[model samples]
Target: MITRHFIDVPRTDGSARRVHYRRCGQGQPLLMIHQSPRSSAEYAAVMQAWGAHFTCIAPDTPGFGQSEPLAGTPDINDFADALIDLMDALGLERCPAYGFHSGGIILVTALKRHPQRFTGMAVGGYAIWTPAEMAIFGESYLPPFQPSAYGEHLTWLWNRMLEQSWFFPWFDVRGEARLPGAHADVARVDQAVREMLESGDAYRAGYGAVLRAPRDIPAADAVVPPVLISAYFGDPLQAHIDRLGPLPAGWQAQKVDTPADHHQASLDWLLALPPVPAAGLVETPHEGFAHVVSAGFDGLVHWRGAVGETATVPAPGGAISLITGAGIDPPGHGLSDDWPAAAPTDRTVWDAVFAEVQRLRGFAGFDFEPITAGDPHHLYPDLTPDRFGSHLTRAWSVVRAGAFFRPRHQPSAANAIAFDSTAIAPDRLAAKHLALLQARSARAYHAAYGRTDGP
Candidate 1:
């Protein structure tokens, strides 16, 4: 089974840094580096496939996911050193490394400086940028992705990732370098958007470093570990193979027709080699903390939830999603990081959040009601009494503990309650959701019609 974890690495500045990683299988230790603005979550499927043959460790590169970002605007070498630090912390002396896109840049640079640390390497889409290309990317690619009042940045991010294949660099206007792989799958785009939100503007730090870093392809007779570079036809970097002149004696480059073929080829190449038996990194259970742009809020949410999707509790009448001022489907309650520090206290803000959620889920007909999150235990960073003390808080606690004091009468199974992963833990904190929703729904019903009778 694939397990998720975090390890505390000692930083050069004498500060402890947390690096999050996903691990599975029990063969050789193979370090997997994912592209920037993405986390170890990207390699879950890859780990599942490759785990039987090798111990896969995919980290959420610095500044992305739950892993801590660098102290400042670090360059490629800093990023590479951070990775090497991760290796050292894990006690991996020498092992093959695999990287993708931006990850390829870090691995290549790391291998160059410390060739003795790796046995073999497989890279997908190693970028060899021209000055003009770099200039273009530097100007438009890694823009600061901060949250806006109306969630405008989200619109840009979704389009940016979706249109990346439509136009090679995504921001290009002339339709040059158009890719055949452009897609519009909401779920696919949603995942990347959530990761980017976790990264916030820090993506500029990690991703920009790779794009601006110098590239040095090893010479034909250069003494280094075996390396294989491959890119699928649809990947823009496939064209860069020609840019690499005079590969080293142990280097091999190939252009595959598809990503699956590319992945399979890389796997075959690695499996043919002898195993790398290295001790696994010390593991710590994930604390279920991550960030996402959800409900018009850009900030920390707890207990592992994805953006733009809630559990699809199918009710023939459709779902009625419960959102609150605070609590895990949290909006107010002091947990959400809002730049303007807006609260959903106003009906207008709740309406705007509902609209944004609709856009994210990419569907309509679902209903929404804003409830008061009176339960203090449901909040994180712990809401202070001075800030949130009120009748609602005290009253909600009574409603939660008292089973008979349900707010809404028993709605038919035809009506399933839904809440964003942040507002409520999908499974662990589900009971709180039930009590909170029942009370709030019943209260709304009681207010509307002086009666709490069952349907």
Candidate 2:
């Protein structure tokens, strides 16, 4: 069952704010932070899935929900500190986390200053606002604290918020033009608007809190944890999407076209990942493409660009010249210029890879992994392919009939002991693979089976 309680979290401002928080389920703790202009209430659906795997703890940031506001000034940094205080109070020394929008900003701040306190983080719609973006937001988001008239205030907030989100130029203009290349479910939009209206001044205060916030939230590269950035269509954060490209190596960017898609994707990601260990680097466009080709392995070769039949293959340690999609090598074609086709040719090549994986792994051919639930190769993306390849190549050394390769648990005892071969099954293999992927626990196996680790 979901459990909630009220507790006072002391701010650095020498005052305490009453925070409404909910904690549920068990296992490693997970702290969830809500975006500005919204309270922790937004994460109700997410908590259900996450709670199963984590002790999901969500708190209403001060000035939103039923929490008390700061008497003077507070910014994202302050919010981070408050979260730390909450963690200490709850006796959670370290916890993995997820956040949305402004909540993501706070998480970033916390990551930079107190990196050790968190296990890892997954965030949705981070806006690394530029100076110009800040100026635009200040005007619309940071409206006056005290409005002259209640009706005028409500109308003004509604128009500003809606226009900023749905129209082009966002804070710069007012129009009915749908944002360029942006789309959303009409019913969802209606529901969000209805909720926003119902929340009243608390929403306004949180909106202003983010609007007036300091734009330069420093990147905590030192705090290397596996971070996933998820974005939806019509999200204003898309404008600053490129800024997220150069984050900590362990960080990953996932773009979902709709809110519902983003929600589901995030839930799946959180459930799959564990506390990060080594600070791995994210793959840049060139590095990513190079790895895709050089490895000769296949799953997904994802790249981000708009409107281009032409693509450039990265040269050895350098940027290669631009060439047609058919011209470059992402495993699919040659430079015989073809006319514009209805669908992308790359999709066909990807389909071929899927088919190959299916044939070998004996699973369904699907775009994303987990081709079918309970499939042995369902954990394809999460499994470090290089390690799996090494194991497969050296199968004789690691395995014998009635005994499977198990990472040595400790160095002091029998290095490799025989286990019942009948117990070795596909589901057991999948579970073992997942346990190894958890960054923190991966090293725990090195003492046993000292096979080379891979990304």
Candidate 3:
């Protein structure tokens, strides 16, 4: 089965980048890089197809999916560095790779900078734009992706994704550049839209870097790893093949008729090469982190500092390992990646998180009672409808803000000291929690559906 995982990798600057990836099959590693505005989720279908032959590791490139983006306006090479950092952290000395579009750009950059790190590469549609074309796209292809309080951006986003297939430069409709493949598929559009939502403004940062990046086509004299560049007929950049005048010794370019043909060609090329064993996942000894196969969520669930090592929470038949804290990316905290758009409720999320904890740690049940700042109970009441607002408020807040960065439902005990808990007496904590929750609800309302009135 295809499995999801997260590994904390420190960049060259010493900041940690929690890289999230999907892995399956077993053999030599084949690192898969995805195009921007999408996650490694793009390779879900392809991973299964190629998993039997190779241990396919596809990561949500920084700032796109679960993995965090680079700090500030980073260069495209920074992304290449992130890839190297991930490889080093995962213990992958050298591996073959396949990249598509912007993914191809990233891998090519990495290959140029460090040729010994990769055995070979098979890339689909590497963009080779002229100076003027680069300028046009760099300025307008991707805009600032921040969320508007009224969600006015949604209108543009939906249309932009849908119309992208119809037009080369989506903004241009000058008749000559209209694409024959331009058509709408709800499922396809929805998938991209949800990813874009998870990405938010970070899309511009990642994608913009690609547009601004300089290409380094290997010289014929330079000894480099083999590379295959394939562009399907319908691909927008198919013509760029001619633009690539000369290639290195082992480099070859092909113009394929269809995506399936292109994919098969790439697959065959990879299988033809020698396999290099990838770094396997390390086992957690006692109290640490592990990627558990949860029904809905797939990422790391940490069991450090939750409870004692030998201690088990009382349960029905046996006992459950105490596991707490959400994952560390968008939506929640600990180490999970992006939250889905359909979006589950607080109860469902906790239940799913804990269930994975129980199953992975070989426990029958769990006794997880988190008393933290953003605990769902603060927004949602179990029995009596408490003064705190409904869970919908927080969910909507997260949806609108494009993230739940600072969940304002309930403050920790330290905050009580911060807000003068003793002076306000008995009702102080309760009042403060309710006030914060309601205030957050109003902001969510404004951001989600443009409701400006305070709760």
Candidate 4:
């Protein structure tokens, strides 16, 4: 089974940053890096496949996923260093690594800086962009992605991710820029959109760093670990192999016919390398999250504050506040796990779940209270995604209404509550909007909990 974890890596500034990762399978450790604007979630299926031979460890590179972003505008070198920091935190001295697209670029840069840190690398696509292509990409590629007051950004986000499969530069609509594998797959596009939303504007920092990164393949004479770089037929980076000029000894680049073939080739190459032992692997504890496996549920549950304190589950549209640190997102809400396939309908299921959480967190007793409002059917809107992305605006409307009224569905002046101007600010609403999007099971959780009366 695949599991998620968080580890705090000490930085040069005498502080620590949390890095979120996914781990599965067992054997020698294999570091997996994902492409930009996406998280380690991208490697879920592949990790399961590769788990039999190696302990697949994939981290969401800094600033892209739940991982904390580096200070200031960082360059590619910074990202490479961050990967090494993660390695050190995990006590991984050296291991075979895998990457795809932007992931491959970061791995290549890391190998160049610290050659002895990796035994071998199986890279899916290593981009070597020319000056002309870089010019076009730099000009119109990554625009500022701040959330707008009315959620206009969501419309652009949905289309941008959707059309990327249709065009090489995504924004370029010319016939020459069209991809042969152009597709309108909604599921694929929706996942990408969610990831980008998680990263928010931070996507520019991580993705821009790669776009601006120089073609840094080590020289033919430079000593380095063996690396195999391959790209599939429909991938735009397949043509970049020609631009790689000359790779160091023991390095090779080739084109493959399909994604399956590329994955198989990568697995074969990594399997041939000497295995790195798992003796040094360390289990690091994350500060604010706990792994809970209670009756009818199993996954990470994010919590804050000392055990035995006031434990409260936030309402349908609520999240654990940074100020009070009192609320916990129930299973299937916020950063907690999604509801199980056969999730229990009984409201008492939550009482047992919280009890398990208290046990896991070392709370003495069940001195807890759940905070809720409105009817379950009315409090949680059906923000299910549509092809046109109307869900984005719908979510924004609900979140915005929540600021001025109790049981946000009732927007009458009689239901209005007093609040500061900052309550309805765009940035604040954007945060709530994101929480709603992230809460995959908010509606179901509410349905199970039923409703309560409020002012």
Q: Comparing candidate 2 with candidate 3, which one achieves the higher lDDT? A: 3
Residue 121 of model 3, lDDT score: 94
lDDT of 4: 0.82
Clashing pairs in 3: 320-365, 326-334, 327-333, 327-334, 327-335, 327-336, 328-333, 328-334, 328-335
Residue 413 displacement in candidate 2 (angstroms): 94
Query: Which candidate comes out best when scored by TM-score?
Result: 4
Give per-residue CA lDDT, model 4, range 1-455, as digits (tens).
78777778899989998788888899899999999989999898999999998899999999887888989999999999999988988989999999999999899999989889999999998888878999998899999898887778888999999999999899999999999898877777878888898888999999999899888788899999999999999999999888888888999889999999999999999999888897244544433556777777877787755666666667655666423545566777667777566556577776778888888776554323343566666777777787777887888998888888886889998998889988877778887887787777766666666556310
- Cα-based lDDT at residue 37, candidate 4: 87
Error of 1 at 74 (Å): 0.7
Please give the ranking of all candidate structures by lDDT, highest first, separated by commas. Answer: 4, 3, 1, 2
- Give, for candidate 1, the lowest lDDT window spanning 10 residues: 311-320
Cα error, residue 315 of model 2, in Å, equals: 75
TM-score of each: 0.66, 0.52, 0.70, 0.94
Which regions of candidate 3 are displaced past 4 Å? 282-356, 359-455
Q: For candidate 3, lDDT tens digit of each residue in 1-455?
A: 66776677866676666667888778888999999889988898999999889999998998987678889999988989889988888888999999999999999999999899999999999888988887778678887765444345556776788888888888777797788787677667756765786677888888988888886578877799999999988798899999887899989999999999999999999988777875687322333445655546655544432332222321110112112332211122322332333334444554565555655555443332222233344333332221221332333343322122223343344333232324234232222222232231221212222211211
Q: On residues 79-170, what C-alpha lDDT tens digit does candidate 1 reach at each position? A: 99989999988889888888999988999989888888988889998888888998888787878765442234545766786677688888
lDDT top scorer? 4
TM-score of 3: 0.70
Q: What does candidate 2's lDDT look like per residue over 1-455, in tens digits?
A: 45545566655677665666656667767889988666676777778866777777887787765456655566656667878887776667776788998888888778777888876778888877678766776665454532221123334443554454567554555445457543344433333433453344456555665655665533545446567788887776765667764667677777778877877777777767655322112121211121131122332232222222233432111111122221122222111111122213233433453344334323322222111111122111222223112322122121222133222212233434566644454333322322222221112112212223310
Please identify which of the two predictions, 1 or 2, would achieve the higher lDDT against the true structure. Answer: 1
